[model samples]
Target: MVGHVVRKRLYILVFAALIGLTALTTGVAFIDLGKWNTLAALAIAVSKASLVVLFFMHLRWSSGLMRMVLLAAFVWFAILVALTLSDEFTRQWTPVPSSWQAQVQQQAR
Candidate 1:
């Protein structure tokens, strides 16, 4: 049986890239970009994950059926995350009335 062979040099390069991306993620964590920080961190994380999956996981040399399955999995994950985030972001949290607060305090005691 024939098998696919990955070169050592390519593996080393991918390893270096993953390490560099990790450093970038850590560096970005120290800076306060407010809302943009999450987006930046997620982008870097996705990049790193992609590199690992493509090289180390051998997805790059995989068959079309395997790629299709992986794509479906990613789509499902995105859908779930989107639904959860939408529900969380759309909720309205209203403050409780003073009477209710008093009742809560009395109940606690």
Candidate 2:
């Protein structure tokens, strides 16, 4: 008998979990948790991504090599994000052009 018996049930459960998490994310958006709102949204997003990767991508059934590759990819992604944020955080703000500032002031009124 084949070992990897594909289960429709598992997919259904994962789908349901993703939907629930999405609803939770939507609900969280309206509440003013201030700093925690971003953290909560990020946590839920990570959970959803993990579910999609493990279940939908069948990474759970993947070989060790595949997992190592995934880990390496994550590391690379982390490096890229860190570098990007570093550049962003160190940037200098320039004064807006007079014309644009005038437009912005007009819009505010």
TM-score of each: 0.84, 0.80
Q: Write the per-residue lDDT of candidate 2 for residues 56-97, one digit (tens) a residue.
A: 888898889999999999999999999999999999989766
Give the Å shift of residue 26 in candidate 1: 0.8
lDDT of 2 at 53: 97
Deviation from native of the Cα of residue 36 in model 1, angstroms: 0.5
Off by over 4 Å in 1: 95-109
Report the C-alpha lDDT of model 1 over 23-86, residue by residue, as the tens digit.
9999999999999999999999999999999999999998999999999999999999999999
| Overall lDDT per candidate, in order of appearance | 0.95, 0.93
What TM-score does structure 1 among the candidates reach? 0.84
